[model samples]
Target: MSDTPTEKPSNRPSPVIVLVAPQMGENIGMVARAMANFGLSELRLVAPRDGWPNDKATAAASRATHVVEAAAVFDDLRAAIADLNFVFATTARERDGFKPVRGPVEAARTLRAQAAGGYRAGILFGREKFGLDNDEISLADEIVTFPVDPAYASLNVAQAVLLMAYEWRKAGLERETDIPFTGPQTVAAPKEELHGLFGHLEAALDTRGYFRPLAKKAKMVDKVRAVLTRPGFTMGEIKVLRGIVSSLDYFSPKEPRGAGYPLRKAEVDKQAHPARRAEDAGEGSDD
Candidate 1:
């Protein structure tokens, strides 16, 4: 098989991110970073409080300089989205009119569909503190609300833009096929090998008296088996863990009384006076 993977180009045009009366330079930069993260470009600023070409914004954007440098500034909301055929206004509060409302997912889907059909689209983000006024929201084609806690529904301007942009990118994928992995490939361990590991661990723990209160031994063993089995450990992982257990067993310092005595003391210390042990240890340590 060829080592080089094929590149697929998207047919849909990315939605423009428009900020209405944004107050902070840092926030705009963060918005640019979020846009870059999800592959969306084209930034439009409407009457920014700190003005355009802000140094703070450029500094905060870090590697997303293209989005920051190419950002366009406009005088008002209407002028900001004038060239776009479809626009979505993000809001946390309810509006007075019967304007159609959509969540980020639905809005992204519609935006993608519209963009594919050769229509320009954009999403409007309001100010940080009070958000967009009624008139500003009314100018957009639809209102977008996040499914958030009603008691505290506010989201930062950059964060709101990130959510919408992320959804828009996610809507275009037919399947998730770009996940990365490292190390040599191996199949999961066979059931017999897993059973052997369980038995080996149980035998070692039995010698160490790990299952306390004799009556609860069976239940504890079951719980231990359940945890070990859930991960579906591969043969490589199983061998590594077995080797670790063996090395631990070989190198472990011996207690004078018994293996279980130190464990019992630790449990008692944890339940009774947690800080007492730490203080005792600190007194003897050179550091």
Candidate 2:
């Protein structure tokens, strides 16, 4: 253990430590030690390279046995992050796509602040060699990195996690704020409600012939659901969307297929490609 004295953490909720596709057992143990040092108890491992609970790891976490004992293993990154309301991924290199990147301090502030708001926030640490993949980064709400000597900024997995944990704990102690995201209770639309809204959307789209080319309908709808499910829509937005669907259904003329006949290509096409319909209708003036 480093000789540094870690301050007693407040009752504030500690951010979850998630290892995504970590390569080494030693690194995993070190990450557990880091979390334990800062009063963080939850440790989640996602598809580790070396099988988990290895003796080498237990030896590494000499004093932080509790962290090792309580660590949870996950088959995939998404499952590991399922419970986290706010998630941040840690990486040394900037990923290609746009995602808010914050230094350890900024990330600590954001995570702690979000936790104060009643959400459980998690920080994802990827493999030592490649770091987080683009698909894994997509799971995070933000990205966090530590500032080292720019010329030599490459940090190993354990070191990176330690730095982040240290900064986060320090910030939580120094800024005595009243906010902490309580247990999991994000205001996202309930699953049942969202499912109902999806049904309405499918029905509405069917009326408009949006799902044409029979073979593609299922795949397209699945993609739509996947995208919408990831962000977690809110009740109000779901209701609004349902209302829009209803209005579209009201205005849409029924297809000639028997009243009970399943929706067909043309109807789906009309609803899906409204732009084409408007073009065909020749609605008065050009924008």
Candidate 3:
């Protein structure tokens, strides 16, 4: 394998990474590099201490000049997030708040759902010295705290940003590439297939009265869709899911149903998916 880096990523519906009151210009560059590494290009700077047009940050960004050059400088956090429909604040310190707290993975999933719903979202990263203040954190609708040791919870601004960026990319890759091995007939379920899956499952659930209370049905469906779309399900996996849903909704196992639901494509058995079987055996190793 070549040692060169790549991926001049295209524009996508990704969360805007907002750095709030960053202190060091070099750290800002490093954060930008981290974002670039993870295919995130939208960068927002809010009242950096050294001010805008920092040469040090741009120099530190290495090849991520595009992200640095396109970065938007905002006077304040409110103005920075004014156009965003949802926001997540990253902080290590525990504080009193009614907002929901989640890990990076869950936050990434929520961000993806928000993007799918055509809503802009952003994540706030605080100053390198002391994380986001109580007031700043309060501005965010949700909190994303890293699962670090409680005794030493603090992380460098770049490190914190890198963690979130990695999770965000991982949530999307879903075994598409960047792996040592891949399963046979590994086809990433395209956005259309995912949307189709959502429509199918939602319709099935509706017939079973799964959505309770008419007023909250939309919100409930949104949450369910988020969970379903969280996994990078393959095309085969999507077919299996649709087939399972069809069987449950239409066929009666106890009664005299002639046959179970048939998938559009022929089903592959255990022998056809050795990679998945390997993954199943290796579950919890990373945890």
Candidate 4:
């Protein structure tokens, strides 16, 4: 890796976030806050509850004044999004199955890809109490929903805006996680390493007569291997698992499972030279 930091990906004009018939000024302000966090600036309001130039909104914006100041108020939903090339309506529940539905991540990526071709897009968020009526959502080109618990699927107006905005910024970046700080990347263990781990674990289990019914041993081993490998463990995880297996295979304490096993040499060393642990943490606390 290079010692120098790379510049962030160049961004085109972001999607316009339109809030339809928003009830609370604070929620509108927070929507601006969420938008500014992810590099979005355009904000459109349709028949806001308490009227425009809301002082409550400006106070709640938390210094995201630019988005709030430039916000455009509209008489209705149709006129608000008339100029946009594409539009998305956010909903919590599954509606009548006419329009295509998308999740937040896919919707954001689609918006970003379209922006690159000089096309514009907008995301519509309904009010806090009652979301977009069927008539309002019908105006959007597509529907987007959050995969939240069905029992409590409703989201705060600002919270819904935050999710869409976060996904939009993530779509612009190259990293899968799109986080600020990161440790050394570890990839999935190679097949050779995985096979060795399976063999070692099976041998340990075999020695302990773990397969009660001998006829079922092979099927049981297959199941165990399949379950362990399904998660695609990284190389570091493979090492840790092998260490655990080696410990269990070799070390036999006089006490039964009630008493814990002895600490390893590394743990003893850390206890003896406590400062080493602090120095290790000073290397940036990877955990």
Best-matching candidate per TM-score: 1
Q: Lowest-scoring 10 consecutive residues by lDDT in candidate 3?
A: 1-10
Question: Residues 37-99, candidate 2, lDDT per residue (tens digit)?
Answer: 777888899987888777778888879878888889999988998978999998888787598
Ten contiguous residues minimizing lDDT sum, candidate 2: 174-183
Per-residue alpha-carbon lDDT of candidate 4 for residues 37-63, written as tens digits (9 for 90 to 100) = 878999999999999999889989998
TM-score of each: 0.74, 0.57, 0.59, 0.62
Ranking by TM-score: 1, 4, 3, 2
Better of 2 and 3 by lDDT: 3
In angstroms, how far off is 205's CA in candidate 3?
69
| lDDT minimum window of 10 residues, candidate 1 | 1-10
- The sequence of per-residue lDDT tens digits that candidate 3 reaches over residues 1-287 is 22333332434589999999999999999999999988899999999999888999999999998899999999989999999999999999878868899999999889878877889999999988888988989899999999999999989999998999987886765342454344455557898998999999888777666676768999999999889877889988999999999988787554233333332332344347777666667854666
- Name the Cα RMSD for model 1: 9.9
lDDT of 1 by residue, 172-195 (tens): 665323322345556899999999
Residue 134, model 3, lDDT = 89
Q: 69, model 4: CA deviation in Å? A: 0.6
Report model 4's TM-score to 2 decimal places.
Answer: 0.62
